[model samples]
Target: MTKTAKLYRMVMDKHVCPYGIKSKWLLEREGYEVEDHHLTTREQTDAFKGEHGVETTPQTFIDGRRIGGYTALRAHFGRREADEGGTSYTPVIAVFAVGAALAIALSLFAFGAPFTVRTAEWFVAFSMAMLAMLKLQDVEQFSTMFVGYDQLGRRWVPYAYAYPFLEATAAVLMAGRLLPWLSIPIALVIGTIGAVSVFYAVYIQKREIKCACVGGSGNVPLGFVSLTENLAMIGMGIWMLLRPTL
Candidate 1:
């Protein structure tokens, strides 16, 4: 027996309800033959909402039972939304994902190959630059979080504020292959300090804190993953230094 569902969704001249499309897709995916109803005008949509006593639309009916909006439909299908707040790596993941894509695109344009040795270099450079941009978004807020765990950041508050700019400068220089002498040292120094700070604070001292690497939000938990970010910079610096010899 084929199950059937009815969906009431907003379809307007200038705008279409995104959730309505999603609701229809979900119903079909669940093996329900959906009778999709389009409320083509604002007045029609409003009247439908009023009749159903719903604040929003893409309302679904499964066997005469109201299944609510897209979120509600998702719940009915046992789906969970991505964890967003408190402590999560979503922001870091998002930044790096975009960074990696940009790295590939840049590499493809310059080297005509997505997997060139320069691609790896670009990945690190771009990721670092993007991360620095996040910190630069709110220097004051980032410095406040950074002070709690960073050794140099604790000693001099101003250093914490200057750190993001330094990071970004190094990253940009590395990306452009500009002034290896200056950029390499900056990368090495900042990376070494960051790695040592993370090691002592999280591993030795066993302090639980947010990673300032992401941004002002302080949602990403300070841990080995954060340590890897610093390690990557140090590794990149060393690799670049050795590249001229080999």
Candidate 2:
């Protein structure tokens, strides 16, 4: 039988307010039943924290265990969530990897094969390299964006340093089909970023940014096609997260 656990998020401050809401959303997404207990009064909140040995709001108690806050919860749940999701979408991810390979091949073949693909290409390549690195250590590259590559401060934009080398390693591994396990996660991460970039341009950004996805000089708008591509890639990532290892 599945375990039923109670989680309590103490919302004391407003700055940390979004933490609770985001926590609730994540739990719901993972099919968990969250019961909220709002303690606005200092006396009540202090007493509650003391009882649980918690020193802050947005404190989470999982099955009676005092799991600190957002980072704490992430530490406990992130891998499990990734594992659960990854295990369910093995087939879907395989299909996505195949499709990605075909797209790259076709695009290369169609455009008369440029001497090299740069920028986004390198970023994607690095992502795959990270995947291989993670699989070697039995970790999940859940999202394509790596904290290691975060150099744009609050923007979290990827840096252009050493990305090509990183991705090239993965591409080499992939070319030889040396490790299917590693390649799958790599593809999922790149596909997701591509999809999200396309989506943000369409829905959030609301600007027709050209899809430099494959390193072509083509400037395309944020059209329905881009949205569809984004959704498809995100779907692939979701599936990879859910699918099990074969």
Candidate 3:
């Protein structure tokens, strides 16, 4: 049985356009049947507004699915198909990278002079970068990937807290240089989470939802770049793990 290409209607007027022609260009590339219903009259604009609140041209409909606004439309198509899965190397590589990043991060605090604000600040910056990257890469999926917990609901409550709590801990340890051994477990936990996120983002593209790792409005969509970054962190962590002593 041949599956029909889903019909997507986009009504765009010149005045209240979103992304201008850029939105249309992207929609066309995504195989949408785009028709620019340019509304020149107040009556036309009003009628269009009545049908869909906010008379914005470039309003997208995917087989009757009203994906309003340019941002929403981008999100809809940018989402990967649920059935797709990640590459074989994604998880293994990511784990190694995260592990290594943690190890190096921990060492920074330990090796640096104690009670120095400079060292503390450096560790803070490094930790911030790592957390930003993880959030960008959608680290929230780690719980489901490694622990088999429900991505939704309190059954997977621990993963919810792990993202920030552990990140802060990693940074703290790196700054205080306290119990470098503690870093090993923390690294392991972060690596496990990162590995899972890479796996799902690559393979189960659509099923994986965005991780608002950073609290902000305009989130970057999760993709392979994120996976590779997480993988690098894993490698850094592994290097640290093998070091003779913390």
Candidate lDDT values, in order: 0.90, 0.48, 0.50
Candidate 2 local distance difference test against the native: 0.48
lDDT accuracy of residue 71 in candidate 3: 68
lDDT of 2 by residue, 50-131 (tens): 8877786677666777777766777778644444322132332443465456546644675665333322243234334433
User: Which residue pairs collide, candidate 1?
Assistant: none
Using lDDT as the measure, what is the rank order of every candidate, best first? 1, 3, 2
Q: Candidate 3: where is the Cα deviation over 4 Å? A: 1-155, 175-177, 205-209, 216-218, 244-246
Per-prediction TM-score, please? 0.77, 0.30, 0.37
Candidate 3 residue-wise lDDT, 85-155, digit = tens: 33233333454455456545555666753444343334333544555445435445543332332233235
Candidate 2: TM-score?
A: 0.30
Candidate 1 residue runs with Cα over 4 Å from true position: 40-46, 90-120, 133-144, 242-246
Model 1 lDDT tens row, 78-105: 9886665668887789888988999899
Worst 10 residues of 3 by lDDT: 1-10
Q: Using TM-score as the measure, what is the rank order of every candidate, best first?
A: 1, 3, 2
